[model samples]
Target: MYPLDEAARAIVPNLRGAIDIPNCGHWTQQEHPELVNTALLEFLKGL
Candidate 1:
């Protein structure tokens, strides 16, 4: 999916802002919950 994502972005740069939450597959949030939380918090703070 990462490679496919890259190819899609290459063809359609406008979709680069998309956030692909690969929850089921190697779930980054579950694997690294603290990291994910920190990033989320920071993003919200920015907004």
Candidate 2:
């Protein structure tokens, strides 16, 4: 609902990061499923 990149960058600690899906709004997963899935997979793989 908000600008999560800036907020997450501020509060999510050093090891974590945020993604800003360009041309998308609040419903990122719905609007950009492939991009979101790719990001999620990459993040999960790192874990």
CA lDDT scores, all candidates in order: 0.68, 0.80
Best by lDDT: 2
Q: Encode model 2's per-residue lDDT on 1-47: one tens digit a residue.
A: 34676667677666367676678998998999999999999999999
lDDT of 2 at 17: 72
Leading candidate by TM-score: 2
lDDT of 1 by residue, 2-32 (tens): 6577778888976534345554457788877
lDDT (C-alpha) at residue 17 in model 1: 41
How far in Å is the alpha carbon of 2 misplaced in model 2? 13
Structure candidate 1, residue pairs in collision: none
Off by over 4 Å in 1: 1-25
Candidate 2: pairs in clash? none
- Tell me the spans in candidate 2 whose CA falls farther than 4 Å from its real position: 1-10
Query: For model 1, where is the 10-residue window of minimal lDDT?
Result: 15-24
TM-scores, all candidates, are 0.47, 0.68
